[model samples]
Target: RFMCDYDEAGSIGKRYRRQDEIGTPYCVTFDFDSAEDGCVTVRDRDSMQQERVPMDQLADYIAARIQF
Candidate 1:
């Protein structure tokens, strides 16, 4: 099981950049709005592509990318 420990001192954008520097393949942000909408933006590190997908199905979406 994986858990996210938020860096309270860092902004979300900075967190994303840090993850990129560490070669993280993708980033998933859970915002207040996400719970209601069931969607969040997915950021691709290498290509810098961003897409919006459902939070309900995010795990499978991310797992698919990790296999590549």
Candidate 2:
């Protein structure tokens, strides 16, 4: 099973750092733009890379890379 955490207590960068500290492999950010584009920013903890992914395809996208 996978776990999901919702945090909105700080700046985006701070939030990312918090998750990174806990070894979260990925962090998805849904901002104002997401309301229009239906996309979210997916950040990779190790690589520190960010990518915009469509909401509809998000499940399969994360499923493909997540390891149990």
Candidate 3:
């Protein structure tokens, strides 16, 4: 199983920064549009690249890249 954390106490930037400081491999963000689009923003900590991934496929998408 994968460990997940829910954090919404600060701004998105702050949240990203916090995760970056801890060397998180990826960060998934569900914003207002996610409810309608069923997509979440997946950010790569190393590349600082962001992509939209459908909620249903999120797990597989991350699993494909994660090396745990």
Backbone Cα, N, C clashes tallied per candidate: 0, 0, 0
Off by over 4 Å in 1: 1-8
Clashing pairs in 1: none
C-alpha displacement of 35 in model 1, angstroms? Answer: 2.1
Clashes of 3: 0
Worst 10 residues of 2 by lDDT: 1-10
TM-score of each predicted structure versus truth = 0.74, 0.94, 0.94
Judged by whole-model lDDT over C-alpha atoms, candidate 1 comes out at 0.77
Q: Write the per-residue lDDT of candidate 1 for residues 1-68, one digit (tens) a residue.
A: 23444443588789888888877777777778788888998889888888889977888888777753
Stretches of model 2 off by over 4 angstroms after superposition: none
How would you encode candidate 2's per-residue C-alpha lDDT over 1-68 as one tens digit per residue? 45899999989999999999999999999999999999999999999999999999898889999977
Q: For candidate 3, what is the TM-score?
A: 0.94
- In lDDT terms, how accurate is model 2? 0.94
